[model samples]
Target: MDIKLDDLTGSKIAGLINEHLQGMALNSPQESIHALNLEQLRKPEITFWSAWEGNDLLGCGALKELDPYHGEIKSMRTAKEHLRKGVAKKLLQHIVEEAKKRGYQRLSLETGSMDAFEPARKLYASFGFEYCKPFSDYKEDPNSVFMTKELFKK
Candidate 1:
């Protein structure tokens, strides 16, 4: 699969992003939905990427710089047709490698704490991320699950 930076164009990546946002709206509360729309994900602070196999978009994810040494994972989504195919995991590993390349000491993320999010949590756990207190402007919310991983800079 080819993973590269992309714009907010009308493509399968954009469709997957919309699907992810809609999924969040359905499973998370109104105030707890931190997922970004295509326009918001196109901002300067965020870098978006889509993974594709030939003409098919497999998955996508983004990295948002919260500060010079800290970054947050955003917009992680795998296409419905490609679920359980390691798309999300590959995108996540790419994001982590990119963070290391940019000198980020840590990578953090916020996902749901509900059953709908267990698979996501498990995926994150496989990457060495652990539960942590909320960072950035986030506050305590029962529906929110915070996690972080320290980069080894290898």
Candidate 2:
């Protein structure tokens, strides 16, 4: 798979992001939905990426700079047909590598606490992320789960 920075101006990426947000809205309460829309991801603080295989859009994830030393993962989603095919894992690995490249000391993410999010939590766990309190503007919400990982510059 080829991973590259996404400009978020294309119809395909827009559709994917909207789909992700829609999925989040369905599983989490209105107040608990934290997924960003295209305009939000286009912010200068956020770096978005999408994985592709030829013409197929496999998955996508984004990293938001909380500070020079920290980043928050966002917009993580794999295409429905590509689920369980390592698409999201690869995108996540790529996002982490980008964070490390930026000299970030930590990477964090927020996911749903619902059963629909179990696979995502497990994926982060496999990458050594630990459950953590809400970071940034988030607060304690029973519907949300937070995870973080410390990056070792290699």
- Least accurate stretch of 10 residues (summed lDDT) in model 1? 8-17
List the global CA lDDT of all models. Answer: 0.93, 0.93
Tens digits of per-residue lDDT for model 2 on 1-154? Answer: 9999989998888889989988998899999999999988899999999999998998899999999999999999998989999998999989989999999999999999999999999999999999999999999999999999999653
What TM-score do all the candidates reach, one by one? 0.96, 0.97
**Candidate 1, after superposition: displacement of residue 139 in Å?**
0.9
lDDT of 2: 0.93
Off by over 4 Å in 1: 152-154
Candidate 2 has a TM-score of: 0.97
